[model samples]
Structures are given as structure tokens and as C-alpha cells.
Target chain A: MEFVQNFPFICIILSMFSAIVSFILPGKAAKYLHIGMVTAVLVLSAGTLAYVAGTGESYTFMMGQFPAPWGNEIRVGVLEALMAVIFCIIMLLSVFGGIAHVEREIQRSRKNLFYILLDLLLASLLALIYTNDLFTAYVFIEINTIAACGLIIVKKEARTYVSAIRYMVMSLVGSGLFLIGLSLLYGITGHLLMTPAKEALEKIIAQGTYHVPLVVIMVLVVIGLGIKSGMYLFHTWIPDTYGYTTPTCSAILSSLVSKSYIFLMIKIFFRVVGFDSIISSHLVNIIFVLGLIGMIMGSVAAIKENDIRRMTAFSSVAQIGYIYMGIGLGTTAGVVAALFHIIVHGITKSQLFISIAGLSDVSDGKQDFHSLKGAGFRCKIAGAAYTAASLSMVGMPFFSGFVSKYLFASSAMTAGSGRLIAAWIVLGVSTILNTVYFMRTVITIYTPVDEEMRKVHGISPSKTEQAAMAAMILLNVVVGVASTPIIRALESGLAMFG
Target chain B: MDVIINMLRNHYQDIAAVFLFVIGMTNLLLQQNLIKKIIGLDIMDSAIYLFLASKGYIAGRTAPIVVDGITDVERYINPIPAGLVLTGIVVSVSVSALMMALTICLYREYHTLNLDEIMMKIRKEED
Candidate 1:
């Protein structure tokens, strides 16, 4: 029982230690070490999750034997543990999918640095997910930023450098706003821990005091995390950043990295600022409207994109909108729908990127629509995976994406009449928009081409890549087929969130 | 009207922090020079740190360090925000360094420090 509580720190320290060890070891050795560490992290995460689920208890472990409100702490509940498990599994898969690409694209010396950055990234993300202290989350957010930059610029193309800089600017602005918001919360609550902060906030809300500061915090945190999550109007950096980065980096960026930020946003919504505060401040409504707009706008942009990777990157923006829309619904069902979509989108998006990697090879490494023509026939595995992923993204029946969309729309009906209609319209149009871009890609890739152009350019994926792709597709199917159980788990998890 | 004036008088420090924040964000959005934008980012970070440090200040309090005999809780201004600001400052420093590294890279390739010019060059190259 006690050992389960220790798992969070053990996993975090293990990753950080591996990062340092990677620095001293050779690149090939570091790669092997990475493989071993991820395996261990997976075990620790799964065990922690099992313990939390079985016991149905949340535990807080204080650092250095210091009590709460004075010393640092890491808190893990069923939800946080579930997030950690999903993160480690997806991270390991992303790295596995990208290992060959990393070797092919990155210089041998820099390969070690790439793995080191990925290791540090995994550590910071786990810390970000588990940390109870707001200040700790802020520090880890910065580490996440710097590590993401390292991942983005690992290939060292001039375009990646430019894209990385733009991303840094966007990220700095986001974190800067988030820091000020945290400072405000501190100023009001006199506590940095989530539970204590919520207690203080609840007192103020009860007394109807500090109404202005509470609203300020709500607004700032939403905008801050929104920018980080690539919501519309703040998502200018996504296409350039995601499209220019290597397939592995792109997969990691789209899947776990942004998803974790969004997860934190959901946590703050549920934990720190109570649901009443969220509604009273009109923040949730604002999020709802902005989400509706972003949903359509992102899909519109994606439909206009010519590059295959860029199109998928833009689709990520729309997918994020769906998650926020669920949150905007401001119901328990809505929140669970959002969380379910996070897992579903994380898997499906990564599958798309990994398959695109194989597809990119067959097209002479060019990732434009014209280049991808007929390439699907050449690489059967990636094509099959790509077809499955596209179907999921379009919310076809019997896929995970369809389930989330169904949940999101049904949850929207719980809102008032006007908001319901708005949510329905946006969701309907965006799904169609998603189909437009994804289906076009699917069609173009499968279209038959001349024999001269059909000269095989890419070899079959190695074993690791194949395994990663298969796992992604299989997970999507499982999530869809067994959604009832997962949804029940999520419902219970959210019920205990506060 | 009187309540507004009273609130402003009491919260001048917060007001200043807000002012600096707006200035920093405006520079980030409006400036074309990459270095200035980076400076703008630092300023925004400084504004937040300033806000945090001010939040910890009390009307009359000694430093947070504990004395051998002083036991009163009110004797020390809040120490947490000071520690927090210091950490925030460190994070911003590393971010600044990364942003600078990026700027240097862009400068070498485009031979310009203006973001718009560099972007233009890249677009031209693409075309």
C-alpha cells in the first residue's frame, strides 16, 4: 500500500536519472537505456493505476517528510494515475515508432541528445501530471517547454529553427500569463497546493469576496493553457511547428505534450476553481463559444492545407476544439467525454503521424498531397493504418472518435436550448470538415498511378515500427469496442475529482 | 466612484504590474525586431515575478529568515512567494537563453534580426 504511494516519485526520479545517465553514455548505449527505463516506467505506472483503482483511494506523498501547506507534495488519484499510465504508454510507443527515423534523420552524435531530451520530457510530463504543488507544475512546464524545443530542433533544418522560435514565443506568452494567474491565486489563497488552494478559494467564494481576483485567475488560466493547447486564435504556431518537425517529434507534440497541458486545464477547472466559480465567472461559456469557433476554423484551415503533415497538424487544432467543447458543456458527462477524447485522439493522431512516416518514404520524403499519390499501395502496412486512423478521425461508426463525438453532442443537449443548437452545429460541421481533409488524403494515397512512378521508394518498416503501429490501431479498436467500461471508469474518476 | 479611487490607491503595485504586463505583451505582438520581442518576453516574465514578490510583502515585516528568539508568525513577510519568484526567474532565464539561441540561428541563415524579414526570406526561398 505504501509502496504504491511511492511510485510517483520513483517513476519521476528514475526518468531524471536516466536522462543524466544518457548524457555520459554513448548514443547507442543511451538508446538501450531509454528502452529499459520506459519499460520500468510502464510497470510502475500500471501498478500505481491498479492500486488506485482497486483501493479507490487518493494519496498525497509529501517530499522530505514535510507536511502540507509548508513543504512540497505530489498527489496521485485514480484520474492522475490513469493519465500517467496513458502518458507512459503513448510516450514509449512514440519513441519506439521514431527510433528508426531518429537514427535516419538525426546525426549520430545528436542521437544521444535526442534521447536525453525525450527522457527529460517524459520526466517533466510525469511530474506535471502528478505534482500537487502549483509552483512545481510551473517549473515543470518550463522544463517541458525547453525539452520540446530540443525535440523540435533536433533535426536542425532552418525551417525547424524558425518553427521552434515561433513555438517558444507562443509558449513563453502562455506560461507567463499562467504564472501571473498562479501568483494571483497565491495572493488570495496563501497556499500552493491544489487541495488547500481550493479550500481557500471555496471560502472566498462562499463569502462572495474577492470576486474580481477569482475571475481574473479563471480567465488567465484558461487563456494561458488555451494558448499552450493550440486552441484557435492562439494556434498560429501549430502548422509550422508540427509540420516541420520529424514524424516522431510531431507525434509526441500532438499526442502527449499538448494533451497533458489540456489535462492540467481540466484539473484546474475541476479541482482548484470549483465548478461554481467556473460558471459564475462566465469563463466556461466563453470557452464554449471560443471552442465552437475554433472547431470550425481549424477544420477550415486544415481543408485548405496542401501538405499532408500540415493537414494533420491542422486537424489537431480542430480535435483540441472538440475537447474544449466538452469542457464547455460544463457537466460531468461533458468532462468525461473530454477525457475520453483525450485518450482516443492521442492514439489516433499518433497513428496518423507514424503512418505518414512510412507514406513519406514512398513519396521520396516529400509530404505534399501530390507526392503522396499512389504511395499507399506501395506501403501496405502504413496505408492500412492510415486508413483506419482517418476513419477514426472522421468519427465513423464503431471507432473511438465516433464515441467521443457522440458523447460530446449528447452532453451538449444538457445545456440550454440556444447553446445546444450552437454546439450541435459546430460539432456537425467540424466532423464533416474533418472528413473532407482526411478523406481527400485517403483517396489520394490510394489512387493508382503510372508504373514508372510506382517504383518502390520505401522498404517495409522494421519490427519496432510495425509493432508500434499495430499497438496504436489495436488500442483504438479496443477503446471503441469497450468504451462502456472505460466510460464507467471515467465517470467514477470524475465523480471523485474534487 | 469613491470605491474605485480607494481600490486604485490600495492596489497601485498590482496596477503597475498589470501595466508592465500589457506593455510587454504589446511589444511581443507589435514589434518586428526579434531581439525586442525577446526583451518583451523577459519584461512580461519580470512583471509576473514583480507581481508575485509584491503579493508577499506585508505593511511592516522583517525578512523571512528565522531568528533565534523571534517566534511571532507576523514578524516575517511571506517567504513562499520570494522562493517562487526566484524559481520563476530561473525558468525565464533558461527560456531567454533558448530564445536567444534560436535568434542566433535565424540570424546566421537569413542575415537579419527582424522577424518579418526572416519570415519573408523563408517564404521567398520556399517559393
Candidate 2:
């Protein structure tokens, strides 16, 4: 086997090791460990992405001496490797951009703990991305949930505590349903590894056995992950959970954490359940209608939100809705579109959240629309970055969001009549709504202030933050302008999904 | 009624598990007190464990371990669900503990155990 094949397991193990080691280190040491670990993971994943894309083959490494049904495994492909690279880059940039807020918002005694949770979060996300065993994925999902809760509660405020609890309660419910679903699936298929489970399911489908139970299991898993990823009506906890946290926490949770759950769902759909069975089950129709509602309703909520941070949080619900709508299309083109949107939204949203820290710094730590007036002029770097992010999110030409939106539209054109119409109508209306709120926020921040408000003055972001913001925005534009290769890579990568 | 009776007769374990799950979920969602909510979560977890355990059990099979070198597959019950149940139990304990710790923090700040009351107080303070 090539040495690059070991990179996937090493990335997961190294992150987990760092998480454990960070608990014993000082706060500054932990921070350094975090940066070093994320950078190392990024390099490793980039190398793996290059190799996997070049070879055009996916490989699975056994966790123990046993293989197949008996052993846990990690599967690495171009898609998984590319996702790992993007996750690491976004995590590193988020940390660098929001370290100031981390210092200010988190208590001194708990800073190391914060890094520990971040390391664990990274580990669990990597595990979720690569794991070939359904049971292993479940264990890591719980770990991810716990680490995310710790990240939120480290802020030490009543609001954070409340939101953290709410987040935990909802997540626990989701995981419970997921666990039960897995249990039923295991009972029926008698395999926990995804490939074996897929084989077993295919046989069952051929024999026309246990059809009712299969449908129930599908609903359980979908609803479980949907709630966790902030799908539609189940997203009530998002604003509180995403709004009250520190900027880094908010960015990571919005961009990486939720996306990991959605990615895992997509994996289960293609690998374990089999796309044919999923389509024949007609659950995609339900997901389609719900995602359509979510697309419009989420943007409406964002428009009504008075608080700037909460508005951005609401926008995430809409973004997540778009990804699900792609999944609901139930075609390979649709899944590729969903995967592309995942990357674009991850990049654009992190930039938006991290820039908020800088913008609010100049606005006397206020995040309301009125107090944020002229924040763009005060913090020029943040203002420019936020404007770029908003433009991308609004699907302007030469921005990453435009590419994903274009992909979704083209993918929708291939669907059946009813769905094609629904997808286009929702997509068009959602884009207009996206424009309304995002452009309005941009105008609000850049609006000139009177002399009385000018006293707040420019509070330039630190060099590290400025550089991170620049890297993120550059990535956004690059992914936009040079999207053909990425989309081709995704198409080829998804071909190897099973 | 006969169909319901037939389901209850054969799949009693699954029926009970689903019942317990619904009851626990309702409690978790409807209960106002933080402790009760945590209890609800625990009950829900227990329902899953029970379901898993029942799935693994067989009427005539012995324990998974071989006695007297009887290595036949049919001699033992399925062991995967047992392992999964154990993992689920450990996870639930940790989650319940985390929830309890959060409850303690909430009580420390507000001197109340009611989630609705706490949220109301927070909104009041925010304004």
C-alpha cells in the first residue's frame, strides 16, 4: 500500500492524541498545539487529496487485523480527502481570526479546555468523514456532540449555558433516534460495516423482505441527522446556540460541525441504504418539500431578525436548506451540487462569522443593526471581507456561492417536472431573499455615521486575523472562478463512493 | 384488535421499547423541570438499550462465551447488540452527567430548576 493511504488514519489519531495531550498543557501551549495539529492535518489531507484524485480510486484501511464485517475501517477517497483539507483550513483560519475573542470571551482558567474540545471536535469530524463502520460513526457522533457542547459552555454566561443545554438536549434526542435506527438496521442486516450492510440490504430488497421496517429505519436516520444539521422546523435551537457563542465557536459550529452530520447522512444514503432503494422509498419527496419550506422560511426568519448575529445564524438554516434540497434531488448531479455547496457555504459563512468579531470590536462590542452602522468604515479589513462574503452568499458572479447556485439550478433542470418546478421556484425565491437580507446588512454596515458615532474610531484587526480573513476570502473567489476542476473532482470522487 | 393482539403477542419486546421511547421523548420535551428532562433523556436511552438487548437475546441459546469448547454459532446469542448496548450505556451516562452539570450551573445562576423560568429570566435580563 502507498504511504499516503495511512494519512487518513494518522490524521484522526493525531487529532485525538492532541486533544488528550492538550488537557495537560497550559493554555498557550494548548493553543500552539491546536495550530500545529490543524496545520499538520491540513498538509496531510492535501497530500492525500492529490494522491487520491490522481489515482481515482478509494481505499479502506482496517482498524484491526480483521477485515470487512469484523473490523472497523476508515475509507479515504478524493471527496473525503478534499473535505478534510477544507475542514482543516477553515478550522485553522477560524482559530486565527477569532483568537482575540477567545481571549476576551473565555475565562483564563478554561482556555486550555477550549482547545481540548476543539481538538476533540476535529478528531470526531475526521472520524465521521472517514469511518466505514456505522457503529464507529455513532460513537464519534456522540463525541462530536459532547465536544461541541463544551465549546459553547466555555464562554461562562447564562445565555451560553442555556443555549448549550438546549443544544445538548436536541442533539441527544437526535442521536437517540439515530441509535435506535442503527439498532434496527443491524438487527435486520446483521452487519455494522457499511459495505456489508449495503450488500445485506441489497439482498433484502431483491427478496422483498422487511420493507416496512426499512422505511421506518430510513425515516429515523434522516430525521435524526436532519434535526442535528438544523433542517427546517427542527432548527429552533440554532439562533440561540449559534448566536450566543464566541465567534470561533459560532463559525466552526455553523460551518464544519453541522456539515459533518450532513456529510455522514449522505454517506449513509449512498453506502448503506443504496441510492436505488432510497429513491424507490420515496423519502426524497418528503425531504424535498421540507427543504423547500426551509429555504423560504429560514430567509424570512433572517429578514425579521433584529440582531445581526442572529440574522446570520438564521441564514445558516437557509444554507443548510439548500444543501438538503440538492440531496432531495436524488441524482448524482444533485449530490455533487450539494457537496459543492457544502464547501462554498463553509468558506463563505466562516468568513462572515469571523469578520463579525472585527466589525463588532469597532462598534463598541455591539452586534445590533443600529449599533453596527458604519462598522465597515471603522474596520476596513473586516468590512471588506464581510462585503466579499455577503456578495458570495448573494450569488454574485465570480463568487463561490454563484457557482454552487448555478450547479443546483443545472442539477434541478434534469429532475422530473414537479420537482424541477419546485426546486427552481424555491431556488429563485431563496436567492432573492438571500439578496434582500445580505445586501441590506452590507448597506447597514457601510452606511456613513454622524460625527457623534465617529468617536468609536477604527479598531484594526490583528495581523493574524487580517491574514486569515484574506485567505478565506481568496479561497471563496478561487473556488468560484476555478470551480470546473473542483466539480470534476467531486463527480469522480462521488463515483467511487460505494 | 386481533391484529394488534397478534403484534403484541409476537413482538412484545419491540412494542414495549417503542412505548417507552415515546413516553420518555414526551417527558423530555414536555417537562419543565431540568432534572425531569435529564431523567427523560435517561429513560429514552434505557428504552434503546432495552430494545438492543432484546434484539440480541435468543430463547434457547446460552451466553456468547463457549463452554466445553462448543464453538457452534447457533449455540450462542448474537453478541453485537450486547456490545452496542454497553457502548450506548456509557455514552448515555456521560451525556446525563453533562446535562446534570449544566443544570447545576443554571440553578447556581438563577436559583431555579425550571427551564421555562430560566429562559424567561434570561430574556428579561437581555432586555
Candidate 3:
């Protein structure tokens, strides 16, 4: 039991160790070793979740055996466990989807380095979700950014390098703003703990007039996290970066990296900043406006993109806005809906990306809609999986997106945000736009082809690819059907905020 | 005038930090070359370090250190931000190295270091 209690942290350390070992090992041995390490980490994370669920106690461990307010403490509560489970599942699927694509695209010499950076990225994400201290979160965010940048440019292409550099600049600015915010909180509280920070903020708020420094700090934190979250105004780097990266790299960045930042933003907004001031001051409206813009603009831009990856990249922007709009409502149901969307979108988008990988392979990099004609019959399972995932993305009934979007719209109405109501209309229109574009691609895949064309290029996915797609599709269906239980669990976990 | 001067003197450290930050921002915005932009980023980062260190300072205080039998030791400037800046410096260095590697890759790919020319080529390719 004790071993299971320590499992999440242990998995993080093990991942880091494996990353080191991956760097040191010979090239041919490294890929297998990396997969072994990730599988082990996945098992550890599962054990941790089972232990948490069985014991119903939060697991707490102070790093370096130091006490609170000084050294970091990793807490594996229900929320952390839930996020861990999601992260591990997505990571496992990514590995499955990544193997063939990585093997084909990455140079032989740099393959080991790719695995090392990938493991380090996963390790940093796990650490970010587990830590309770805000400063520790900051450190993990920095590590995550660096590791993500490395992974993005692993192929050393000029476009990839430029996009990575742009991402780097944006991340550093965001981190700087976040640090300034933290400093302000520390100046008032004399402690860096989340609970203490909240208490201190309450005391400051009780003085009637809000402190200018605190407001400045809040704005700084929002802008900083906004960049990391790739919210509308700060999202210039996203399409270019995701467009230029490989499918596997794009999946990792989109599915995990963006969500981790959103998670941190939730932690900061609810736990550290205190929701009372945020709602009372009408900053939630500002968030809603930005999110609405993102939702509308992203979908419109995506409809115009011809490149498969770029279109998907823009779609991610719209999806992120949906999550943010839910959170921006400031209702309990809204928060839960947002968290649900984060998880569901993570899995569905990753599956979609992986399936696109198969499409890319079959089409010989001709990833346009026209080039993918009749691909459904060629690789039936992947095509079916892709269709199912895309249906979920478009919020078809009995699919994952439908549940989250329903929850979000209901919550917005309950919260009485007329702006959010209008935002919901925008979201609905965008959902239709989303369907128009994605369905175009889907239909292109299944459309009848000339008999002569079929003889020349009848590429089907391998068994592993088929299995991976099936697993992802199964997850999408199961999560859709069983969303209520997960929502209830999330509600219980978030009850502490109320 | 006297009040303004007093205010300036009172917040001298903060004023200096903000000044340096503005300079860095201007350089970053105006600079055309990639390496120069990196230099501007460093300048901006150093400004933040200065701001943090200044926030930690107290008048007539020495560096934070403990000695035996120092029961009546006067207040010292906060050491936490200094420690944080050390870590921040390391982070910035790593970012700089990555940026340099990216620039090297960009040069290799485009056979040019000028951002405008490279962007033009990319636009041409897109069209």
C-alpha cells in the first residue's frame, strides 16, 4: 500500500532515469528501451490510481523530506489521479501511433534523442500534475516548454526551427509574467503555499477596494497562462508550430502540453486566485469574450486551410476555446464540463492525429482531401476509427464531444451569462462548420475510386496500427457512455473549491 | 518637483528595472536579426532578475547568512529571490542554447540567416 502511495512520484523519477539511460544507450536498443520505460510508468500510474480509489485517501509526499512552505510536496488526490490516468492513457496511445511514423521519419542517429526528450516531457507533465506548490509548478512548466521545443524541432527543419523559436519566446514571456504574479502573491502572503496564498488574497480582498498590485498580478498571471494555453490573442504561434511539426509531435503538443497548461490555469484561478474576486470583478466576462473569439475565429480559419495538419491545428484552437468558455462561466457545472472536454478532446484529437498518420503513409505525404480519396476502403479499421473520432469531435449524440458540449451549454445558461448564451450560438455555428470541413475529409476517404487507381495504391495499415486505432475508438465510445460517473467523481473532487 | 524626485529616489530599484525592461522590449521589437533578438530577450530577462532582487532588498541590510551566536543579527535582504534568479539564469541559458541550435538548423535549411529572405522563400513555397 505504501509503495502504491508513492507510485506516481516514483514513476516520474523512473521516467527521468529512463530518459538518461535512453540517451546513453546505443541507437538500435533505445527505442525498445524507451517503450519499456513508458509501459512501466503507465503501470505505475494505474497502480497509483487504483490505490487512491481503494484507499480514498490523498497521498502526500514532501520531496527531500522537507516540510511545507519550503520544499515541494506531491499530492495524489482524486483530481491528480484522474489527470494521471488520462495522461498515461493518451501517452500509451501516442506511443502506439508514434512508433511507425517515428521510425519512418526520424533519422536513425537522432531516434534515441527523440525518445529521451519524449520521456522527459512525460515526466515533467506527471510532476506538474502531482505538485502542490506553485513554484514547483512553475519549474515544471519551464521544463515542459523546453522539452516540447526540443521535440518539435527534432527533425531540424527550417520551418520547425522557426516555429520552435517563436514558441520559445512566447513561453519565456509567459513564464516571466507568471513569476511576477507569484512575487506579488509572495509579497503579501509571506508564503508560497496555495492555501496560504488564497487566505492572503481573501484578507486583501476584505479591505473593500482591490489592491492595484494584486490586480496587476492577476492580469500578469492571466496573460502568462493565456500564452501557454494558446488562447486567441496569444495563439499566433500555434498553427505555424503544429503545422510544421510531425504528426506524432503535433499529437503530443496538442493532446498533452496544451491541456497541462490549462490544468495549471484552473489550479491557479480556482485555488490560488480565489473565484470570488474573479466573478465579482467580471473578469470571467473577459475570459468569455476571448474564448468566444477563439471559437469563432479558429473554426473560420480552419475551414480555409487545405493542409490536413494545419486544419487539425486550427481545429485544436477552437476546441481549446470550448474548454475555456466552459471554465470562464465560473459555475461548478461549467468547470466540470471544461475538465471533461479537456480529457475527451485529448483522447479524440490524439486518435485523430494517429489515424492521420496512417493516411499520410498511405498517401505518400499528399495529405490534401483530394489525395485521400477512397482511403476508407484501403484501411477500413483506421478509416472507421477516424470517422468515429471525428464524429465525437463534431459532437454527435452518444459521442464524447456531445456530452461535454451539452454540459457546457447548460452550465452557461444556468449561470445566466447572456454573452455566454451568444457564445453558445457561436459554438453551435462553429460546430456545423467543423462538421462541414471534417466530413469533407471523411467523405473523401470513403468515396469511390477508379478501379485502375485501386490496383496501384491499396495501402492498408499494419496490425499494430489497427489495434491502436481500435483501442482509441473503444475509449472514445466508453468515455461517451460512461461520462456521468466521471463527471460525478470530478464534482466530488472539486467540492473542496466550493 | 521635490515630491517627484523623492518618489524617484524611493523607488530607484524598481525604476531601473522598468527602464531596463523597456529598453529590452524596444530592442526586441526593433531588431531585425535573430541573434540580436535573442540578445534582447536576455536583456529582458536580466531586467526581471533585477526587479526581483530589488524587491528582496532592505535598507542597510547585508546578504543573508547565519553565523554562530548571531542572536541579534539585523534584517538582511531576502535571499529567496536571489536563489530563484540562479535557477532562472540556468533556464534562460538552456533556452538560449536551444534557440542557437534552432537558428543553426534554420541557416542550414534555408542557406541564409536573414529572416526576411527565409520568410520570403517560405511564402514562395506556399504559393
Candidate maximizing lDDT = 2
Backbone clashes in candidate 2 total 0
lDDT of each: 0.87, 0.92, 0.80
Native contact fraction, candidates in order: 0.88, 0.68, 0.47
lDDT (Cα) of model 1:
0.87
DockQ, per-model, please?
0.84, 0.82, 0.59
Encode model 2's per-residue lDDT on A1-498: one tens digit a residue.
Answer: 889889989999999999899888999999999999999999999999999988889999987668788988899998899899999989999999998778877878889999999999999999999999998999999999999999888888888999998899889889989999999999999999999999999999999999999999999999999989899989998999989889999999999999999999999998999877888999998888888889999999999998889999999999999999999998899999999999999999999999988888888888999889988878888988999999999899999999999999999987788889899999999999999999999999989787777555545577888888898889899999999998998998889996
Full candidate order by lDDT, most accurate first? 2, 1, 3
CA lDDT of A485 in candidate 2?
A: 90
lDDT of 3 at B103: 77
Per-model tally of clashing residue pairs: 0, 0, 0
- For residue B49, what is the lDDT in candidate 2? 93
* Docking quality class, candidate 3: medium
Better by lDDT, candidate 3 or 1 = 1
Report i-RMS for every model. Answer: 0.9, 0.7, 1.8
Q: Which stretches of candidate 3 lie over 4 Å from their true place?
A: A55-59, A208-210, A455-460, B1-3, B25-30
Interface RMSD of 1: 0.9
